[model samples]
Target: MSTTSGAAGAAYDVAIVGTGGIAAIHARDLAELGERARIVTAVDTDAGRLDDFSRRWSVPRTYAALESMLEFERPDVVVLCTPPGLHTGQALTCLEHGVTVLCEKPPALSLAEMDTIIGAERADAGDGRFATVFQHRFGSGAESLRRLVGDPRLGPPMTAVCHTLWYRPDDYFAAPWRGVWGVEGGGPTMGHGIHQMDLLLSVLGPWRDVSAVAARRARPTDTEDFSAALVTFDSGVVATVVNSLLSPRETSYLRFDFAHATVELEHLYGYDDASWRVSAAPEHEDTVAAAWAEGPKGRGSGHAAQYTALFDALDAGAPPPVTTADARDTMELVAAIYASSFTGQTVRRGDLGPGSPFYDRMNGDGAPWAAAKETEVPA
Candidate 1:
């Protein structure tokens, strides 16, 4: 998978496996790099996706599996674009061969599974970094929101909520792997909500406790169509999160109420779209507006932001945009919610931290460590 620059990319720095839905984004972003980022090889279980990817990206080689591609390509970076369940094993393969990986979210089916890859990364910590796809972090407006959180003058966020209300056609879940617990893992929360959930976790860190309820109210998906949770942060911030593939009209939004101001992240999660609004409370609204006229605030969304960050890191020999440690925290949050909802209790974040029950459980196997609940994702 050696590469020479013709056009579209500066030099070859990485290989991408799994040329599926998200792979297109990686390819397009690399192409747009205009000689900055290149895809050395594209591996896929589907020969057809490889064919399309090769013609589209001007990539030189394609493989049906990671081993062949890793040995053949020996690229500096590998992207795990496969489904969440396949990440743990594939990432380990890439890491063992000295390839850095930018894996998509829910990096492994379980925290235990991710440990295998994380363990390797720890051993090789200074060697190369493993990153997860919590791409929403790159959104243009997100940085502005972060600044807002740190400003005490803006007041503390009293409440925050994330909503992923979107439409999923019957055919969307027609793929057995999608709706099936074994292959896909969890429902809307696990599969779709993970990204926004990461954003939530980023804004409200150290979630102290969580209580959740999940149910498959609509859709044939084996997992829940809808799930809701109430979380308490170690910072004393409270959050309510709800996600679903069951809604008719699509709506994706995040909002927070601070003592002096209110910030609402609207349309931040719908595919190919987003918007946000931030204002001071009525009493402080005027003063905030006066300060706001000083400048504009916001960030990027989706593959556009993520792909650029991922490639730039690979090019400079820097760490990927979102680290594996970031992913672990997000997954632990999900695990806590699942545990709380499934066990009929509230889950504390410390329970999933180092030396906790879930810390060493994964041992990095891609195979399912725990069976999916015939009902909801496990706690």
Candidate 2:
């Protein structure tokens, strides 16, 4: 069961828990780490996926259950790419066994679940920890903009726009869990748009309040197909968020208007340095141009950049990027958006807790609208 190589001392033992399509991404990124990390095993309930992943990644061991994998392989790190409903439990299993976890986005279905994962992670005193895959934060362009946030030249971020508008056909929701509240949590807002929103939260920091609306206008799914929100950041930045699955022309875009310059990132899925553009105000044009040019370059927003940084953290015995606290901030935004939309109220950072329905379910009290609303998309 244990596939510890002789080079175990030179590399961290890495195992993947879910052998889905996304698992391939994790494998590819981990493989790029070379000897710094080794793919010790892969786990999946599906025999076909397990075998395919192992053969494709050259992983030496495979398991059908997480407990068996943990007992046998004892990987130093585990990647949880399972569904949103399963993320919390699977991640808890790994952390309880003192294994670090790199969980995919929407790390938990609800705030309660996030609290449970954070508890387990805290109890585990070792270097083994939890980090979320908010890969957009690692982009060179994003890093540049983040750095510029603190500079006086840009002043404070005043207003911003975040949008994730992509088309998902009927076939995309054929899966049983695709649009359910308990399973996938929410529709485009929670699953698809979260990437850009997380990136937004990363650059802007904590959100103070949210007023939003969600509709199941297009998709024939239980969850809302579209959502829009007005967000107020703690730093007094007001922003608008729009997440949709009905757009024929797909795009993932974020724009931050600071006092002295406007920064924008335009891309469909992932972005490189070239995806970002800076338009400086005339008064601070020279300073902004020079600062942007001197920022970090070349790193693209993807799993590889994050995984490499994770391994470096493991080597240094430091906490990895996008820690649970950081991920919680993004999750809080998600909860707030839903709470506001369904309840028709402005949701604050503390509004969602054990007492609020949204604290435990994305579609609090069943969305307050009919699933087959008149605006439902026709197949």
Candidate 3:
């Protein structure tokens, strides 16, 4: 474990692991940050990809192994764009060395793994912090809606809709680890829909319980291609969530129905102020419109928005946004959806922990379809 000069009086040094497509976004956003952060090194086992990434991003250094990069150049923060299966271990390593970690979505394959990562941060008690990428929560539209959650003008939230319907062809899962339960964790529920689910949880404080169903509809993979759940928040706000990778027309939509207004957001991946709409009850139309108009605006949701907030938190010596504890809430929801679906029972927020099967793996009892697929005789 080595240490680089702190970012006390300079830009935070950042090292990006895994030069995949997502890493490009991280590099571009950090570049846009100008002086807040700097990409000092790039790491990847693929030599060709590493070279290309370094050249494209103008990153000064590159390494084929993560340990070597951490040993020689200890960046203040390591942005992990690696696979889900590797997130827990990689994040643990960074925290052990007192370097903050900004990991991509599905930060871990299971709640157990996520807990380990969170534990590492607490045990370190140093400058290291762990933050997951849940960019949807930082968008201006989401910010505005969050502010009005209990605002008397909007009243109490009623029912909600959260859908992540997208398409991924067979070739899209050509990568060996793409749809595997042990690697990618679960299909759309864990990978694709998590962004919107995280955003939903951000708006609705704490969820109470969930009843769900999952199926391997069309995708030829080891995990379910689609899932749906009915979740109830502590505030008595019930929501229907549907996540699918089989839809032909892709859409990521969320609707929150409050007593006085119905607020909705429609977008594919990211959203801005323009993606939101509010419809008010007759008596509160003007009030709702004025409140919506006065809320936060302009900032679009993406890596940049979250990164900007993260840098500000680091500068102020505060825990970064989307901290492990905060992410745990969203992750627990993912686990509950799976547990409820597989067990044909309602799963409450505190139902899963160390003793729960779903805590260690999403397909805790083995997805029924996957079991059947394995037993099918040669046709």
Which candidate achieves the best TM-score against the true structure? 3
Better of 1 and 3 by TM-score: 3
> Model 3 Cα displacement at 183 (Å)?
0.9
Task: Compute the lDDT for candidate 1.
Answer: 0.72
lDDT of 3 by residue, 1-379 (tens): 2233334324688899999999999888877777677888999999999999999988999999888898998787899999999999899888988899999999999999999998899999678999999999998888899898889999989999999999999999999899999999999999999999999999998999999999997888999999999999999999999999999999999999999999999999888888998999999999999999988889999898998888778767899899998899999999999999999999999899988899989999799887787899996
Which parts of model 3 have CA positions greater than 4 angstroms off? 1-10
lDDT of 3: 0.91
Question: Of models 1 and 2, which has the larger lDDT?
Answer: 2
TM-score of each: 0.86, 0.94, 0.96
Give me candidate 2's TM-score against the actual structure. Answer: 0.94
Query: For residues 1-379, could you state the per-residue lDDT of candidate 1 as single tens digits?
Result: 2355534333656688888878887777666665556677788888887898888878888888889876767776787888777888888877777677888766887777766777998787345668887877876566556656757656777889888887787789877688666677677777888888888888767788989877766677666677899989988888899988978887777888888887777773533223766677777877665544443344357665776677656656677778877887888877776666656678887676555443443211121222334436657
Which of the two candidates, 1 or 2, achieves a greater TM-score against the reference? 2
- Relative to the unseen true structure, what is the C-alpha lDDT of residue 358 in candidate 2, on a scale of 0 to 100? 84
Question: Relative to the unseen true structure, what is the C-alpha lDDT of residue 277 in candidate 1, on a scale of 0 to 100?
Answer: 68
| Superposed Cα deviation of residue 169, candidate 1 (Å) | 3.0
In candidate 3, how many Å is residue 169 off? 0.6
lDDT of 1 at 133: 76
